[model samples]
Target: MLVLTRKTNEAITIGEDIEITILSIHGDQVKIGINAPKKIDIHRKEVFIAIKEENHEAVKTVSLDSLKNFIRKS
Candidate 1:
């Protein structure tokens, strides 16, 4: 992991498109802002993990037979 220390208003650019900036600092809590293209997705770690887990569960519950039946009904 690349650890960095940034004061408020400081920013770091990723590749050529994304910019991460420090917005505010209060004791241990720090607020940050991200700038990226609209086509790119930016999600918090927990939210991203939850989304991945949901996708995994969905795949597990879905089967070819079920899809075929549904398609036949349609």
Candidate 2:
């Protein structure tokens, strides 16, 4: 992983499109602001993990074979 220290208002550019900046620092938590294209997706790590876990549970409980049989008969 690439790690660097940046003070408030300092920014790091991603490729040719995205720019991530440090907005503020409070205690141990740092506030960040991102500038990216509309097509790009941005999510906090915990939120991303939650979304992934929810999708996994939904898939595990869903009947894919039943849906496939119905589609085949249709």
Please report the candidate that would top lDDT against the real structure: 1
| Model 1, global lDDT | 0.96
Model 1, position 15, has a per-residue lDDT of 99
TM-score of each: 0.86, 0.83
TM-score of 1: 0.86
Candidate 2, residue 53: Cα displacement in angstroms equals 0.5
Cα lDDT tens digits for candidate 1, 1-74: 88998899999999999999999999999999999999999999999999999999999999999999999999
Count clashing residue pairs per candidate.
0, 0
Instruction: Give each model's whole-structure lDDT.
Output: 0.96, 0.95
Where is model 2 poorest over a 10-residue stretch in terms of lDDT?
A: 58-67
Please, what are the lDDT tens digits per residue for candidate 2 over residues 1-74? 99999999999999999999999999999999999999998999999999999999988886989889889999
What's the CA error at residue 30 for candidate 1, in Å?
A: 0.7
